[model samples]
Target: MIRARAIIDRDALAHNLSRVRALAPHSRVYAAVKADGYGHGAVTVAGALAAADGFAVSSLDEALQLRWAGIDKPVAMLSQQLDATVCEQAGEYGLEPVVFHETQIEALERYVGPALKIWVKLDSGMHRLGFAPDRVDAIVTRLAALERIEINGWLTHLACADDPSRPETQAQLDVFAQVTAGRPGLRSIANSAGVLGWPAAHADVVRPGIMLYGSSPMSDRDASSYDLKPAMHLSAPLIARNPIAAGETIGYGATWRTPEAMDIGVIGIGYGDGYPRHAPSGTPVLIDGVRVPLVGRVSMDMITVDLRNAPNAKVGDRATLWGGGLDPDEVARHADTIAYELFCRLTPRVRFEVI
Candidate 1:
């Protein structure tokens, strides 16, 4: 029997995509499915997001994964420094990749296969990827000179679109607009945060990542506020339950003790399953759909939860880590991390079943 599993709800995924369409009606949805669809399984969600205009990935192999899975939709490899091999694979597979360097242009020049489409990535203020605003024209010119390639458009990443209170997103948007002025092809600037919080950043292409999987892109809001549904339900079985006396400490490091005599359950999941190791005591876990406080420290393969709130919960009842009734953002807040990391960090040990 599977002790713990992450249930991927494709219906919820499709519902979220509909939300993206509503938010950016004029833009194409380049749904981000990189990091194996944020650990929800890339190929799995691709089928669910068939309505999306295309997919946005992080690497050539990520694109190939979809292609091999029979997903022929346009897949754009997001802004990155490309190598000769990656460029060749991209052309061969009909992928639209972002290019910023002269070396990448040269590699495309050497490619003699089918015609390729490419996007020039400009550093709009993220400073992580993309070419400088001053160098975009030169790079675009060089890329445009390639006989067998199509300059799909310009691309830029927003630094602080997650919170509209920050001015960086607008500054980045301004830089992108000026750099790509009178430029050929379309412009893509919105990620999930941009899709939800910055309508001005919604250019010709909008790539929604975490929000497509049902997590809120902004800190000030929850997913429900955006009409998003929970797409992944993580749950583990309660392995053991024991009555503890008041003042009795629990688990490794003796980090928590019983405030009063109450039953505690041993849940069959922990860091080994990609549950955050640093998740402190009092993090909420849903026991048989009832909220229970996580007690002590998370172990390699187990966790302890106070059953006072779930007095009738049985040893074999499923305990939810997040999703469904519990918001992943809420769980993330308790763990002091974002929902993205929690989704991407799941190990292969956990069973992933599509629903």
Candidate 2:
């Protein structure tokens, strides 16, 4: 079978997590491994980071997958499919749930058995989810009544940490601090961007997601500046090489036309394997560690790359669509998206091999 492969470097993951700890020395690191460790494989990444302080995931199903793999760390589900049975399952696996609204708290009270660890999510700014920060008192009071509930922490999310100059981040931090001011338990407000940019928001815990996987959290910052190494390098072998004449066009829409006779190499990876389809011409790819340019519209199972610089490019040569010598961030930028989407979109059809 023709294989598109991802090389995961466990050492790079360790370095990335270590960088997180260095950035926020006073705060505990919670590695957000949701979306199957952002498409790097949850169980694999979790096991690799077994020394990490804790793991944060999106749902009970994710938490259960970690539990099945023998990861015994403290796990907090950032959000879950709210239901009675799953609430019980969260407790069963020692997974903490984010209680954002009154209904979830009430459900936890009714369905929870022994001890329930809940991270109360406050909507300081990211209106996507969480209870109103001003209503902490009411939410606290409701949770305090449950005999099995242990209010482990106060949590909030940053709306603009990715864009450092946006004053909304500081405003959100101020709001978060105001509400969590006197709370005895842990207070967490740092996502990857928050961990890198907003130091004041790093309270008792810092949840670093993309950064833990060695990708830049902000549009402007380089991941290397943080000493974060990319954990995954996606590559495939060249399948075909052809020389197109000056008048010929390439790919589905014939989006690209050759201006001169040029050698083009076909890489055995495509949108089906999570390579972004919208990648315009001139998007960077790597042939034997030398940069090459993408030449056409990406297809469901293949991508054509310009091999002018790599005159030695051949049918069996390795092509790095992203990862290895070429960074995923560069490709993401050309595609006008974030590294998060690029990483998470990598599908199961691509084989994974840990290095």
Candidate 3:
């Protein structure tokens, strides 16, 4: 069997969902299972989080996949609905489409079918999607005239909820509140960061993504602070161990050199398996349950780790890349990235086992 594998912990997923509920007891959860549950496998995650009020995905196909997997919960497509055909399909599948532009509303207007539940997205502050807040009233009026669709609610993405200190989060929330106040449908503005940091944004519905996978949404705090357990445990085997003399260089570009005679262990995973290539030397990996420093440039299929901290480490010893005791957020920090990218960018070469 391939030693490189990711273990998906269903219990941790459920626990994280419970944490979201604990934070916003009055709000409904639309769990984001997009990007294949951030590479944990969407169907598997949906099964574990079946109790979520709804599942949110990036496309109609993803929502359909969950439905085919026996997930009966409401599935909302967070991305825009591009055409009338997609709008019709969404109605057929009972999937909710997020209308972010005038084109989407027109598409829905043209569709002829049973009423479709739709969430109108407002460009609160992100400016990446959704209509401008000023245009929301006009959009809602047009939407209200559409007889074939039901306005489920209004939703917005937070630009900086991860850092509560940033004034933009509250600014966005204020705009969202002002724009949707007295609206007939539910109003949702919180993502995982909002659920953790900005309680004021926890409106009628909360969409929690990265935090549900046990990663900290905050830049200053760790996941443990929120009692979030990592749902994916990535590990590989040490395929080779070599003794290197002092001043000897290792890996491509000779990015690292030993200051003294030391044992170097080669792990059977790398960027090819979605490990970050930019992860610098001194990044942590776990061998025999002991933390060790990565010693050389991360290669296509391997990474070299200094075994000085774990001399008993031998070939075939298990090395945890992240998860378990080591968090993906820590690894991502060393790579100058976020845990969301680390989890979502995992390559298909890494086998996954649901636990």
Candidate 2: count of backbone clashes, pairs at least 3 residues apart or interchain: 0
Best first by lDDT, ranked: 3, 1, 2
Q: Write the per-residue lDDT of candidate 2 for residues 138-190, one digit (tens) a residue.
A: 88888888888899998988888999989999888888888888777999999
lDDT of 3 by residue, 1-355 (tens): 4768999999999999999999999999999999999999999999999889999999988988998888888999998556977877787888899889888877877889888999989998899999997797798889889888799999999999988789998889888888888888998899999999988989899999999999998978999999999999999999999999999999999879899999999999999999999999989999987999998899999999999999898898889998989989999999999898999888989999999
- Flag clash pairs in model 3: none
Q: Relative to the true structure, how large is the alpha-carbon lDDT of every model?
A: 0.90, 0.87, 0.91
On TM-score, the candidate that comes out on top is 3
State in Å the error of residue 248, model 2: 1.0
Candidate 1 — worst ten consecutive residues by lDDT sum? 79-88
Predicted model with the maximum lDDT: 3
RMSD of 1: 1.1
Cα lDDT of model 1 by residue, 164-218, tens digit: 8998998998999998888789999999999999999898999899998999979
Report the error of model 1 at residue 206, Å. Answer: 0.2
Decoy 3 TM-score against native: 0.98
Provide the lowest-lDDT 10-residue window in model 2.
Answer: 105-114
In order, how many clashes per candidate? 0, 0, 0
